[model samples]
Target: MLLIDVVRVSEAVTRTSARLGKVGHLAELLARVAPAEAEIAISYLSGELPQRQVGVGWRTLQDLPQPKLVATATLTDVDALLTRIKAVSGPGSQAARKALVAELFSAVTSQEQSFLMRLLSGELRQGALDGVMIEAIAKASGAPSADVRRALTLRGWLPAVGAAALSGGVEALHAFKLEVGRAVAPMLAGSAPNVAAALEKAGVPAALEWKLDGVRVQAHRSGSEVHIFTRTLDDITPQVPELVEALLALPSTDLVLDGEVIALRPDGRPHTFQVTVSRATSKTDVPRLRAETPLSVFFFDALRVDGTDLLDLPYSERQEILTRTAPPELLTPRLTTDDVNKAEAFFTDVIKSGHEGVVVKSLTSPYAAGRRGAGWIKVKPRHTLDLVVLAVEWGHGRREGKLSNLHLGARDPESGDFVMLGKTFKGLTDELLAWQTERFLELADGPTDGWTVTVRPEQVVEVAFDGVQRSPRYPGGMALRFARVLRYRPDKRPEDADTIETVRALML
Candidate 1:
């Protein structure tokens, strides 16, 4: 199949929100593609070629201007390129890489080579391929939208999901068991200030867990080969050897377990995320890294054990199986007491111990992969902000030729005067950049018609800053720390965003 065909399908699927349209597009591609070429094509269609998990990205337009204008490579060329990369690397080692470089992309100019280099490297930029893929499957099998979602969530890939859509219908899809290797996030929390408050509204028996300040990891062992991946599915085992050793030490072989890899202080409290970062790379020696950070594995959920799928089991039964299968060092602890008062006390203890707040889970809830729902509640510190966008700057580097940065501002709610707060280049997407450029230009009064333009305080965006800090730059003698755009609220006038007084209230 042609690369153009893949692009065509991707464009069509992405444009429609209807799951059926997306599924139909993918099914057509599958039917047209030969099995040999299907893997790469399917990956590309899913927008996962450059694994979103890996943060693989393109050289921005300015860095390689000509390359961005050039047409994307053909599918056959991409397939050939992948084959070359594998051929040079060999099965067991990276010996094949240089050979691939010499044989393939070398012919393209250094500038062009940079562009084609990424394509050959197998990193596609489009994230959330699975959702698009479910759409593709739905389109192909003529199944209902829910059936596609159910099967894909249970089985985790479009090919099998396509088959499920045809063979068993919606029930088959609903009954589909979650399989390993499909990256999914644990159900995120619905928050309340305290457990007693959450209990009054939430119906099920809650499982109180120690919400450790650590990275979430999923460990997969297939025979002797062990892989450790992040919650998002990017492999991180190479960076963390001690954790891998702990995983390999598990008595039950061939398992995929979910847990947190936390840095333990001498006093037994989990360290800040900064200390835990030392253990996240591939080359660190396990014993030494563990001694440096001393990672404690807190196993919470399990998907595979001794070839039996445990995702269908309730949290209670799954916990039993997980605790039994775990090595003593790897067992994650859980508290089942229904007493809401105890939960509040526990939350306070954890916070006092220098940790994030607790995660309250439903004991009876089946793991709801990839969605934040009421089944789990994360009770963390709450923060509020009403900051303004001062000036919009043209995005450079990866975000080239786009509006990716904002000069943040603070408004005097009473006086209606705007003062610059901080600057940020994070969180805006390609679509967002386009929308902002158009909208901000309309709001432009006179100046800022050029590349980096200042805007009126008439538009207010609610921003969440990590913390407030003392700064010499702004008029207020303080700045928004780690500021990120939360959302654009048009509901209220500029005066309605938090007053400078509210910001002062949050400061030390």
Candidate 2:
């Protein structure tokens, strides 16, 4: 298929705010895609690439050659070029990759160039989310949405799902099942503000487990071969040896277990998220790296065991299977309770132990993979502080031309100066962005550059964050993690904002 077809569909999809319009545009595009071209077209529409990251980023795309007179770039042509780009590595590969990108860029028209740029840079703001794409594929192929979703979740690849649906319809989707060594999309949980709310949502006879501050990992094992996948289904088997070794030693040979991989302190409390992340992403000398960080997997749910799929089983039955198959040490710390006070105690204990909180799960609910259903609910104690905005950066893509990313600061009580915690562009509505853009200009300390504008610290905004981490880059020794603007605190003064000492206390 021609690249123009994909580009036109993406443009139409982005131009519409209606979900059905987006689905219609994609369904129309899918009908025309040949089996050979289905994978690439679906991948592009779904805002992903066949080759993943091909050593090309925003900086390299600048000052490229002008567009060709004709749009001749085919799906196969672009795919082949991406394969070559991914192959370029080590010494002198940067220039080679850039040259390949330029050659490919020069082959397409300016309109196609814009589409390719957005797709490559992950700025594909077109509402072609995975759920929408699955529905579109189902609509085009005459398969049920449930069948397509199940296949996509188990297969964990949209391109393959697209190809299967196009070729064999619902039969192909039914053929896709829980396979050992293949990653499945994980079941996710909804959020509640507190334990009482979570228990109320979960109802009675629920299992409450400590929500460890760690990476969500799904382990697949068949004898000596074991694979560990992140929540997004990225295979990190080679990076975490301890996790692999533990899986290999498990009594059950063929199974899929859902859990968290956490690095723990000597006191058995989880290490800070930053520490765990650095160890998880370490690529070189990983065995030595594993010893340095020493990760552990705490299994909470069993998806499949001994060739029997457990996803359809009730949570109570799945927990029993997990306890039976996985070692006791590998099991997550958990208790079955419906008592609000007992659940509250568990929540308090989790926070006091430096962990995140607790996940209250319905005992009778099945594992609804890839969907954030009410079966499981998370309760985490969120700490909100009134912090002053130090500056704001111009947003990009969807948020372009707006004062978005906020530089948050905590007041240092002794010095009476603000200490930068971190920057967050999350949790801001378009209305908030417009309001802040005009309001901040009035409080600007200097002239605006359209890139970043510094503002006086008189405005106090309430910020909610997960926690703080030790940072080497900031003036303060610590920085906020996962911070988001909850709301503006116009009634509060800069002096009334939380102190750096208060922020530091969270680190402990």
Candidate 3:
């Protein structure tokens, strides 16, 4: 199929707000895709590239060659060109890559060129996320949506799963299973105000584990081969030799453990989140970095052990397996209780130890990967909301040339529109400023007014604030007090943002 066909489907998906409409458009495209091109087509339709990275940047995309008047590039043609671009490296590779990108752009129509720019820049926000794509895949392959979702969770790559669904049907999707080395998406947690509320949501006899402010690691050990993946499933085995060594020391020859790795001080208190993340993600001077800021792994749950998959097991059972396979010092501190007072005390102790908060997990609940279910509830001592970014103002002073001040909005459930709440520029690091500036420009919907740039309300950010107060400046009739950004929520969508009603209830 021509690349223009895929671009047309993407445009159709974006023009419609109904979920079924998006699914219909995607399903129709998927059904018409050739078996060999299924993976590339699915990946592109889902706003991803099968090649992952192609060394393209926003600056390179800024100056493109004139697009062709006709559309003739095939799906395979684009994929092959991207492969060639990704292979360019070493000296003079940047110029060579740019030339190749220009060549590819010059061969496609204007619409195809626009699609290529968004696809390469990683800013394609057509709302056809993995959830919607699963339904589309199921509809096209005549398989159950649950099976498609399960296959994606176990496989951890939608392109591969979509290809299997299109080629081999249900049998191929069912072939996916949790493997020792392959990383599955980690289970997520919902949030509550306090320990009592978390416990109430998790039910009695829940396990409250310390919510450490650290990097999430999913370690798999199969004999001497050990692989440690970050939350996004990037293999960091070389960067985290300590974690690999720890996993190799475990008794089980085959195991998949989900946990956190944090840098702790000599006093046993955790370091600041920035310190831990910086140390964990750094790629320089491993031995020196390890000596200066070593990471301590804390296992919270076991998904696979001794050739057995424990994803369907209850939280209590998984905890039991983890306790037997890992040492007490390596396990995250936990307390199982039916009393809210005990849970509150545990939460206090964890907070006092400089941990972030506590995660209250239901004892009888099974692990649900890639989901934020009610089975696990997290409680922190502050007020935080996941709000959408409506617009951003260019920074001044040291932050000049970057997108700094963020205009925050809360989703209005009734109108399905985002209502502006307030603006904040606090809590952004230099790295975050540069990243958001590039991303917001890609999502830009309106022309810049020299001071502010209006963007699509697709980016969700976790904002920490003191409280909410009445304000007539915002259409929501409220504003956040002392609002500061906590972090960007890439895993969440704008639809997952806190509703306007939820923010207003904070006034009570």
Highest TM-score: give the candidate number. Answer: 3
Displacement of the residue 396 alpha carbon in candidate 3, Å: 7.4
Error of 3 at 212 (Å): 0.8
Worst 10 residues of 2 by lDDT: 489-498
User: Where in model 3 is the C-alpha error above 4 Å?
Assistant: 58-70, 89-103, 386-390, 394-404, 409-421, 426-449, 454-461, 466-482, 486-508
lDDT of 1 by residue, 1-508 (tens): 6565676665565465564555566677776675455656666665444222322223221233222334455666765655555444337444345444444443333444543443433432222245556555566556786667655555555555555555555766777765555554454455555677666545546777777767788888876678887754567877777677887787777788888888788888777565675566436466676666677778888877988877657778888888888865676555676787787888788778877777787767776665445667666554545566767877778777666688877655332356676787666667767877777876664576467877655676756667778788988888888887755654334534555765775575
Structural similarity to truth (TM-score) of each candidate: 0.61, 0.75, 0.87
Candidate 1 — which residues are off by over 4 angstroms?
13-40, 50-78, 85-129, 143-197, 200-202, 221-225, 238-241, 248-250, 285-287, 327-329, 383-508
Model 1 poorest 10 in a row by lDDT: 53-62
Please give the lDDT score for candidate 2: 0.85
Score candidate 2 by TM-score against the native: 0.75
Error of 2 at 462 (Å): 14
Q: What TM-score would you give candidate 1 relative to the actual structure?
A: 0.61
Better of 2 and 3 by lDDT: 3
Clashes (N, CA, C under 3 Å) per candidate = 16, 0, 0
C-alpha local distance difference test of each model: 0.63, 0.85, 0.89
